[model samples]
Structures are given as structure tokens and as C-alpha cells.
Target: MRLFFHTISARKKLVFLLALLVLPGGCSRHKSPRYLYGSNCGICHHGGEGMAGSVPPLSGRIDRIAATPEGRVYLASVLMNGVSGPIRAAGVPYRAEMPLFRYLSDEEAATILSWLSQQGETKPAPTITREDIAAARAHRISAGDVADMRAKLDLKHPLP
Candidate 1:
């Protein structure tokens, strides 16, 4: 009887451990960053590699840009407003335009940005808050200027 009880307890512990490992963020019901990215960004970014001469790949790039003050503003503006016209993303020229994501609330935008910064990363990336998004929102830069903002910065990798 003792051995049987111990075996059951061990099995239960193993099951619980497996459960924790499987869930992306400890099994919360809230939508995951991956899910949000898939719904909102995947069609354009396409597994973060993006389509050639069109959408820019985001997985390895956003956070590096976000780390800077001016870059932060540009990134925020790009997310909030949409960019159009000729642009180079990660060194590739993309004539396609990016549409505004103004529909996303500040919180949702933060979530998306946070996710973008951490793609393919093993650990969590630095978090961007709704307040950060709000501050960028305050700038109210136009979509055209936001797209143009890219010209000012030296992007290590360009987005198409």
C-alpha cells in the first residue's frame, strides 16, 4: 500500500511538472504574445523573415531600435500610425506600405512591441509599458513622417 501511494504521488508530481513546462506563461487564460503576433503581424511579417521587397522581418530588429530615444519614437510612430512610400527595411528596398495599427489600444500595442522585441529569444525581453506607448502616442507624428523617420536613423538591418 505504501509503495502504491508513493508511486501515485510521484506520477502526480511528474504530471504537474510537465504541465508547467508545456504552458508558455504558466497557463494563464490571457492571449499570448505569439498569438497576438500571429493575428496582428504574421500576415505581413511572415514568421518574422517577412516577404522579400515588401514587409520587413521583425524578429531580430525591433528591440535594438527601441533601445534608443529617437528610435523609440520612430518605432512607436510606426506602430501607431502606418508608414507608406519607398523604404528600406534591413537593407532590402520595399515599396509596399505599412498600414496604421491605431486600432490597437496602448496596452495591446505594448504587448505587441514587447513580443516583437523578443522573437526567437529564450528569455523574456525588456518590457515596454502602456505608458511608454502613451508617451509615443502624445507625439502624434503623421504616418508619412514616421515612414520618413527611417531615413534619419542608421539601421544595422533595414526593414523592407
Candidate 2:
């Protein structure tokens, strides 16, 4: 009886461990926006401050870009499709190829964008919803096309 009880306890422990490993958002910060940003965007953006002359800063710029409907759409499109070629951000020119994050789920993408929008010096951060990401996904375009869209947006702080 003692041996049987010990075996049952061991099985219970194994099951609990497996549950923690397999359950969604369980014992894992992967679903958190900060973690997502760190693993995905942070590599280049470097805490959203960017790497001067190489990667454009996202801190102050992201909020301003998200201020308008068109800007919001552009942001969603950029996140889904990525962007390339020469572009101006924060009045500085950068020519880098941002990788497409199409693998990210709508919820994860939205969360990351929304979290990023809240970063920097801007107050009253803009929200990027899953619907926004879904809409961008519906109209699939190339990364280069996303850069073109960025040029056309009438943002408060225009991206040249």
C-alpha cells in the first residue's frame, strides 16, 4: 500500500509538471507583451530606443504614428508585412529591413503593438486591437509595399 501511494504521488507530480509546460500562458511569460517584444522586436529596436543611424527609434515615434486612423492601419500593416528600404523616423533616415512577424497571432501582435504604443514620451497611448491586425492580414502585401504605405500616411510626425 505504501509503495502504491508513492507511485501515485509521483504520477501526480509528473502530470502537474506537464500541465505547467503545456497549458497556455502557464508558468510562462511568452504571452506577455513585454516578453514578446523582447524576444521579437527588442533585438533590433533595443528597448524601443533603437540603434542610432541603423535602427530607428520606436519610443516617441510609434505613439505619434498611431494617432490617426491611417497611421494605425499603416502600423498594423507594417507589423504584419514588415518594411524595407530608406525611410525617415524621428526626422532621421534609416535604411533597414524589418522582418515580417506574420507568424505572430493576431492577439499577440495586437498586444505587442499596443504595448509599444505605450512606450516613449507620448501620453495617452494608442491601442492596437486584434481586429486591426486581422484587417491588415486580410489585405496581404509585400514588405516593400508597407514602406510605400508609410510614405503616404498623413501622420502628425510624418515618415519621410
Backbone collision count in every prediction? 7, 0
The 10 consecutive residues of candidate 2 with the worst lDDT sum are 151-160
Model 2 agreement with the true structure over 71-142: per-residue lDDT tens digits: 889999988999998888877888969988888888888888889889745678888899999999899999
Off by over 4 Å in 1: 1-29, 120-126, 155-160
User: Against the hidden true structure, what lDDT does model 1 obtain?
Assistant: 0.72
TM-score of 2: 0.84
Instruction: Give per-model TM-scores.
Output: 0.70, 0.84
C-alpha RMSD for every candidate: 8.2, 3.3
lDDT of each: 0.72, 0.83
Q: Tens digit of lDDT per residue, candidate 1, span 1-160?
A: 5565566777787786787787765432367777777878887887888887667778677877766666666777787877877777677777758887877778778888877877535355656678778877777777778767777665543332
